[model samples]
Target: MAISEPASDQRRAFVLDLPQRLVCLLDGASASHGRASLLLVVVALVAFLPGFFQISPIDRDEARFAQATKQMVESGNFVEIRFHTQARNKKPVGIHWLQAASVTAGEAVIGPSALTSIWLYRLPSLLAAVGAVLLTYWTALVFLSRRGALLAGLLMASCVLLGVEARLAKTDAVLLLTIIACFGALARAYVRPRAERTGDFRLAFIFWTAMAAGILVKGPMTPLFVGLAIVALAVVERSGSVLRPLRPLVGLVWCLLLVLPWFVAIWFATKGAFYQHAVGVDMLGKVTEGQEGHWGPPGTYFLAVWGTFWPSVVLAAMAAPFAWRARRDEKVRFLLCWLVPTWLLFEIAATKLPHYVLPLYPALAILGVMAIERGALARAGSRLAGLVWLWPVLAILVSLGLGGAYLWFGSGFGLAAWPLLALAIALLWMAARAFPRVGPEGAVLTAIAGALVLYTAVYQAMLPQMRALWISERLAAVVKEQGCPAANVSSFPYQEPSLVFLVGTDINYVLPNEAAALMKKGGCSLAFMDERFTGNFEKHAAAHGLKYHAVATISGFVYNGGRLTAITVYRSDDAPAGSGAAR
Candidate 1:
């Protein structure tokens, strides 16, 4: 009985331990899942936030946006976008509003003039990028496993174009946020039965709200893109009623309610001029003609996408065939409906900016992750196999070539270029080993990680040097150093908006004919003109009784990879003789 009693005691101990062990296992899994979620967030911040404010404001778009936000803060005009008293009605007020809010908040902390802090202008986009990444994870989880969700988030967060847009004060990053939100709601609405969907109106609410927000971000293109995807899904599913649960009438009401207030206010303020410029010139012009010299063949975006997506491009490309083959599957079908039509629309559009197709990338990332989860890459010895090997091969070669070029030609990078080369080599080694065994997820992560490292090194080492070469900030500073009053300086023939922000006061963008007269009427007026137009300015100056001498020769790349412009700074001494007659 005593021996029997010992065995019974042992059995009781085992029984008690079993549930505890299960509880511990559950706890561990929950903890691991939480950590996995955090990993992507950390990766996103690392990808986006570092050196974000370190680089000078990029010219044209970024500077234009910043200046508009500055105007919003100064003029207290929350609805209309303006640049130095000129209405910029092309884009919606969403990005400018957000930037204004950031500037306002930043100024409160750092004093009123702190609106000039470029990071504040860019913060919304960074947060939006992080939001987009998180939303992609959620969308992936709706149809994918936990690992797939993480991978999708990482892939989108690390994409080159997305990252670049995120770091800028551009509309695309925020536009992406609204896009993912709308798609996320669409994914949710589609997954549930029609009967069950009506029980929860939250999804429809989310979808409508996001659509309206997106429209605010970039005008009708947002709705057009999302509506086309929704329509495509309905058609492909052969259920015209697939969108029934969304209740288009109700959603439209919500969209109009959210978007109308500002649109109406701006229209009234500008006396319909806003619509004429925005819809007529900016929006319609892009549709009918290549606005802003961005014309390209239909395949322009298709070719550009590979480089934009980069490190993940091979897997994404491989995933397409498999994705198409499995198009009958509900999630795959939804992704196809979401990705293909929108992608085609952008490709067919008259204007082709790299960021125009950004809204389609989350779907692409989800599809790429689905392929990995489905063992598609494993079957092919992963993305590292065959001609896919050329990706890393070319990447390494490019890295080496760029590093050599920097060493030989570019200034300020110095020995720092070699670290980028090392990163490329490490990526190659990882790809060679991991792809065949660990598959696309592992190989792609290695590549993305290496790319991030390379970018950080290059940006840190080269941004200041690049800024010196690209932005007008240094030239503006030089003007300030020379005691040129902000109001007394003007740019001739060209209005680089960056000069407005960097110079700290509005510099008039004067016409060639008007520049000479203005200089002659004002004492010691300073004019910054492109070197190419010096002869034209000299002719006008000689005729207008303005004696001008080149103050300094300031040369730099207009922007990264843009034209190399050497601007001659000229200080004009007014003679006042027959000056007003020339005007």
Candidate 2:
């Protein structure tokens, strides 16, 4: 058992009191919004910025989002979302618009050549990630002390899912921001008594407007979660008090004002195809069954939360007993209502990805802090105390996973990552070892330290060094180095958006023979033939008298499909093309 905080506070301890002191520092910082905000920004940036610029554009969604936004920047089409003329109608225009703005600003500041930078496209996610972290702090303030709120903010900021989302050019990070804000407002209004909710009008605006932003970003997810939580709250409390303060009519009108313009414009532009795909295909498909291969049985999020939530998850486990025992507490009830129904919905849904439950993570963060403040965390003598070992064990497992992946796909031992991996494992071991002495909340800081080291190694060092996995980045590099800046490129038997985003919009997704034909057309034409179709490319090259030479042969795992994809770039030797090419 741990000593009471009141008892610990009496002593002027240094190392033993480090955890309490750290909590005090965060609490002190939260006294001033400016100082807290700055500190959180620094924390968020450190957590998010490791592989932000260094990593290549991830395939499928991230690349598709970036390409669509690049097209938006190129064509100045704000309403119609597209990926190289194909109507990307599955999503609304909010994230695309944000990404477009980020790219445009980047180009202006760093010259037009900066348009292709993946980091520029990812700016929205990064900034939105920061906003989400700050919002987590603010949201916790509604129900928690300043130190607890700050701790919640730190927990969310260092999270694995949020960190991954922050580095990608996708809607999740921004959606997370809007959802946190929207729920934060709703939580603020609901957790308090009706008489005490003086700023009902302001809360209503924040809730509805943030939900509106979520609507524009992912369409209906934000409102869906809020609606469900409110319904659950109403059922549990048997009161209209939660809904009465929001003034639904006015808030809905405000939300419509913010969200309708784009929907209406996209409706006019896509001839209502946007809604057909966005609703009928994208959103509904997930609800009905697995759209992509992301199918899992129930409790997927439960299993995944261990890794995705990471260090916080250790404390979350310790908080479970508290949650059940204190279920009737208004603060506990509010968080339970906010988390449980939404969590059950996602768990029961056929389509499951780790990030689908990201919005629920904030509730966990606040709840964990609440557990700590109340001395409700599972003690060393408790039956659930063995859960502490999960921290260090997961660290070792994660290290092994990384090292095993590198050994399987890398050139050498990946020496750059091993030291950090060792450090991460050590820190996590320390967290677990210190759990009995320092308690769950203090242990969280140590685990987060471990996570930071681990993520830095994974994102900054390990993943980047896995050159065999970034097929598109390497392909783009081959094309750029071949002395044909404006080469008409063809990727045979396979076309990925990352290639289009990094290479050019002029790429042709052609058959092996057609790729060879593109090469025969000469004038700086290059064909990127997948290894599976390399034989066909060569046969067509011979049959068509396409005089071409192999510029480079690259093999890597295509992240979209998670398979080995080998590509050979062949250039027609008939004529040099592009202004930069040798005549």
Candidate 3:
């Protein structure tokens, strides 16, 4: 009853052709303009809404950005940005203004509470993330099939980097929106009918306005990225005429009109200090030397793409060979023009962060979608089966990795992880069955859905437990629970900015050796020190003529490395005779 060689070969060929047929059908359905818009709307909601405010603001970026915006709300100084009296010069004022406006709107509805209202500060990022996804989809539709546009939108929605940035208070998500807007508009203008597109003025205005917003959000980096793309496109097309519709002379006027008012005002307010720090130190320093300890060799961003894009990265890698094969094609050349130089520039830059190349991710997503639409995966024959199976295999590994990471950090998997684990197992089965039955696109979509589930689990289950590790919320609660006066508390070694925001007090920063000096001026003072200083707390207290006892010990991870630290609270018995405290 075994099949003959010819029959088996025929069946195999039919199976291989299924993906192409399904993709064509999908492309036809996606061709409807309304469907694409609806798909983008769904991506926007899913990308921004769920778990947007599930956890508190994190340390470093989110906490710092939120605090700065909070200061703006309190001070009403829109031109000069400040984070509790320390000038915040790391970023342009655009993000702060947006955050402030969001907060203001939220206040009108829910009443103002800087200490509690995080969702308002995160709203702009959510909206911007949605805009980035929509614009990327629209851009893909310019040159790609309908199926490619849907895939591109879905891939971006499922990206771990965009997901994280969407829910946080940061500049990257907003910056991404502007990048997509400007570039997408340029693509539209370039590809449209020459008579209709040329001197459209409206498109030129959109491009310039988006670029202006980008300059305001992150400063010169915006113009640098867009300008570089323009030059690359001109070279690849071998014609300067392609750049004509951009109307640089008039566009520059529009850009300056949109961006200069605040720059001039801030210059007068900071006496040019803001520009010196934001432009000179934070911006150019990354080019001249490593900044913020982010120095890496050329391969940093190449490696980062794997983690940054996650499930989508597999397709991105799969797209490379096809892209190279079709390098002569104009659309392929345009995508390469967008992705290559931007990627290379980041790699060559002296300083690097994982999210620095976020603006280029839309291109990667587009290329990956194009590869799938062109039937690259199905054309691989038997190799396609293995790649399909890789999805479930990686999903299981990610589940185990998440659980193991928490346990390694001395945290437990919460109840929410149960559903997450079940979802992973389901994805494993779906991937195993789908490729053989449905097609590669089916398997890829399943994988992308699995990634969304993973992000949900991370935000709802893992982050709440991990919040205390990077943030001071729990530590601050402990101080309040112990009835310690805000004025009497001090942190030794260093003070995390989040601690100040969380504890609602000014914590004096002191060194360990200086602990004795604190004892002399105290009324039953309490000191928080790094765990390394715990053993010597009693010894130091006794040496300084004070009685000390450990109150509580709190620990968590605070930085990029998985290193954990314990913070110990110590109480002294001595009370200043004349210094009666107010409760």
Task: Report the number of the highest-TM-score candidate.
Answer: 2
lDDT of 3 by residue, 162-238 (tens): 98898888899999998888888778766754455456587788899999999999987777777787788778767
Each model's number of backbone clashes? 0, 0, 0
| Residue runs of model 3 more than 4 Å from their true location after superposition | 1-35, 47-50, 193-197, 382-385, 408-413, 467-471, 482-488, 512-526, 534-551, 560-562, 570-583
Q: Judge candidate 2 at residue 470 and give its lDDT.
A: 76
Question: Which pairs clash inside model 1?
Answer: none
TM-score of each: 0.87, 0.93, 0.86
The full ranking of all candidates by TM-score, starting with the best, is 2, 1, 3
Stretches > 4 Å off in candidate 1 = 1-33, 244-248, 381-384, 397-410, 521-524, 535-550, 559-562, 572-583
Model 3 scores a TM of: 0.86
lDDT of each structure? 0.75, 0.83, 0.74
Put down candidate 1 lDDT per residue, 1-583, tens digits, no spaces. 4445587677555434433443343234335567656777788888886569777777779988999989888878788788875778888898898888888889889996576678889999999999898889888888888777777888898888888888899799999999899888888878877566553467778888998888888998678777888889878777655555677788889889999999999889889998999988998888788987898879998899878887677778878778878999989998988888888877777988999888898888989889877877666543336645655675677676656645543566566657665765666555545555444555676667666776675555555455435446666766655666677777865467777877754677886656777777767567778878888888898898777776676766654445667777777755222121100
Q: Which candidate gets the maximum lDDT versus the true structure?
A: 2
After superposition, which runs of candidate 2 have C-alpha atoms over 4 Å from their true positions?
Answer: 1-24, 27-31, 196-199, 378-381, 485-487, 577-583
